[model samples]
Each structure stands twice: as C-alpha cells, then as structure tokens.
Target: MAVTQFNTEAMEQCRTTVSSQAGQFGAIGDGFSNQYGNPEIFGKLGASGAVSSAVSAMDQAGAQEFEAAEKVLRKVESALDAIQTSVHDVEEANKNSMRAV
Candidate 1:
C-alpha cells in the first residue's frame, strides 16, 4: 500500500509569495510611469530660453525611447499576474483532490 500526503501549507505559502511578487512587479511598472511619464522633460534640451535646435530632433526622438521600457515593465507585470493566478489555481486543485481522497 502507498500513502499519499498533501502539503497544503506549502502551497498556500507559494501562493502568498507569488501574490507579493505580482504586486512588486505592478509597483515597479507604476514607478517607472510616474518617473518618466512626462514628455516635457525629454522635450527640452540645452538652455530653456534658447532651446538649442542643434539637438532638437534628437531630443524629440528621445522622448519615445522610454516608451519601450514602460511596455516591457507592463508585459512583465502581466506575466506575473498570470503566474500568480496559476499558482492559486494549482493550490485550489490540490485542495480539491485532497478532499476527494
């Protein structure tokens, strides 16, 4: 005869850890947005009064550079959300199986 044991405590811990990680990811994303969400900073380069035209084009183009970083952060946050949800689902499934047994 084989004995099967379920460690639900560990599963719950994992779920908690995953939820925290997801929250951290979301916080990072929000922080990135808050820090660089404004285009005005990237819009102006050199003296404010003169507004150097020499690098004006480059300055304008640079504003969009941070957009990719924001997108990547959002993607990571979304992935973490999925992982967290999957962890919860697995925990529930295991608990159900234990109950059935």
Candidate 2:
C-alpha cells in the first residue's frame, strides 16, 4: 500500500512538470522526442512511422471489403425476391388449373 501511494505521488509530480511545459508535445514529438534527439534513432523512427501508415491503409482496405460484401448481399436478396415471386405465381396457376378440372 505504501509503494502504491509513493508511485501515485511521483506520477502526479511528473504530470505537473509536463503540463507546465508548453509545446513540449509537437509533431511526431510526443513519443519520439528522445529518438529525435539522436539522428540515427530519428531515421529508424521515420521507418516506423511509414510502417504505421501502411497498417492504417490496410485497415481502410478491410473496411472497403466489408462494404463491397454488403453490396453483394443486397443484390443476392433482390434476386431471391424475384425467384420467390416466380415460384408463387407458378403455384397459384397450378391451383387454378385443379379447380377448373
């Protein structure tokens, strides 16, 4: 319990320190500030950013696939409606013929 309280106090102090600094969080500066301080590390960070962008693009593609599949399902439903109507008409015609006989 004492350790938890100590850690919580330390975290609040750190938060206060960060909040006092304006513009400390800038473009690509939030998580990679330390990396940007070193040129070699910054290059690796650029590559990591590219990978992150690619993953986001793939996620968009997955959403598009789901939309396309939904369109196909709607078409299938329309076709099934037509088929059902034809079947019902045929059944009605057969019933009328039996009544005539």
Candidate 3:
C-alpha cells in the first residue's frame, strides 16, 4: 500500500488561488459583456449581421468561461471539506484506539 500525506495548508492555498482565478474570470466576462454586448454597440454596429453575431458569440463564450471557473472553485471547496472530514475521522479513530489500549 502506498501512503499519502495530506497537506491541509497546501490545499487551502490552492483553494485561494482557484477562487481568485474564478473572480478574474467573472470580471473578464463582465467587461466583455459591457464592452461588446450592450444594446448601444449593437445599434452602432447597425445591421452588420456578421459582426453582431461574432460579438454575441464572444460574450456567450466569456460567460461560459466564467461559469466554468466558478465550477472549478466549487470543486476545490468540496475537496477541502472532504480533506478536513477525513483528517477528523482519522484523529477520532486514533483517539478511540488509544483509549482501548
């Protein structure tokens, strides 16, 4: 059997990094939407169907990217919770064993 040590601090750092990235993704999405997806921009583009479509697609892509980042952040949070639970369980088991000894 291979033994693996859990580094809670490292996990926390990873979670923080992922969360910051997610925030960045959301900011980018918002900026893209504001710059290109606004009604005024569509009016200015004025019946240039191809350009409007492209801008809309880019906006959608940005939104999707932000959503993906948020999902990754959620996964990281869940992993951290699971690691903490596992450590607690192990400590409880160890205490029980010592009590019986």
Candidate 4:
C-alpha cells in the first residue's frame, strides 16, 4: 500500500478508538457526580455508609478514566507505528522501481 493511504487508514482507526474513550470518560465523570455529589445527602448518609464510600467511588471513577485514556494513547502509538511501516515499504518499493526503470 502507498504510504499516504496507510497513514490515512491508521489515523481513522485511531480516531475511532479516541471517540470511544471520550464517551467512556464522560460516563465516568457522570458517575462521580452521582456517587459523590450533594453535601447534604452526604452528611445524612453518615461517614461509614455514603460519605466514606465517596473516596472509593472517586478512586474507581479516576481509574476508569485513566484506563480509557491509556487505551486511546495505545491506539495512537499503533497508528504511528503503522505510518512508519508504510514509509519503509514505500521506500523499498521506490528502490525496486528505480532498478526496473
């Protein structure tokens, strides 16, 4: 395949992965709001029950976001690798074509 074509394909794939991760982060943010919001409710629920639980809940939400970001970053790295490979392939192909000419 041509270098440009390969790069385009890789970029499209990476974009898809990033879009998926953005949605995941959005969900995690929403969950954090629901699980740890409302100071009045937090006070009523008591420390051991809901108040203390917010710590764990927030941690879990942060972990989810981190995982999603990692996933998206990996995809970007993969895309870069693919582009490099494509460039190498095109260079080799050009050398062969020059010999034929």
Highest-lDDT candidate: 3
Ranking by TM-score: 3, 4, 2, 1
Candidate 2 residue lDDT tens string, 1-101: 35311243444455454333323322222333222222343366757666655655665565555555555544554565555566668778978888542
Give the per-residue lDDT digits (tens) of candidate 3, residues 1-101: 99868887887787778778767766766666544544555565656666766788887788778777777777777787778788979978988888542
Return the lDDT, model 2, position 36.
22
For candidate 1, lDDT tens digit of each residue in 1-101? 89645455665566566556655555554444323233344467445434444345444445444444555555655665566667778878978888542
Q: How far out, in Å, is residue 46 in model 1?
A: 17
What's the TM-score of every candidate structure? 0.45, 0.48, 0.66, 0.52
Give the TM-score (vs. native) of candidate 2.
Answer: 0.48
lDDT of each: 0.54, 0.49, 0.73, 0.64
Supply candidate 2's per-residue lDDT for 101: 29
- How far residue 24's Cα lies from its native spot in candidate 1, in Å, is 14
Q: How far is candidate 2 from the true structure (C-alpha RMSD, Å)?
A: 25.2
In candidate 1, the residue pairs with backbone N, CA or C atoms under 3 Å apart (3 or more residues apart, or in different chains) clash, namely none
Candidate 4 to truth, TM: 0.52
C-alpha displacement of 39 in model 1, angstroms? 20
Q: Give the number of the best model, judged by TM-score.
A: 3
Cα lDDT, model 1, residue 80: 58
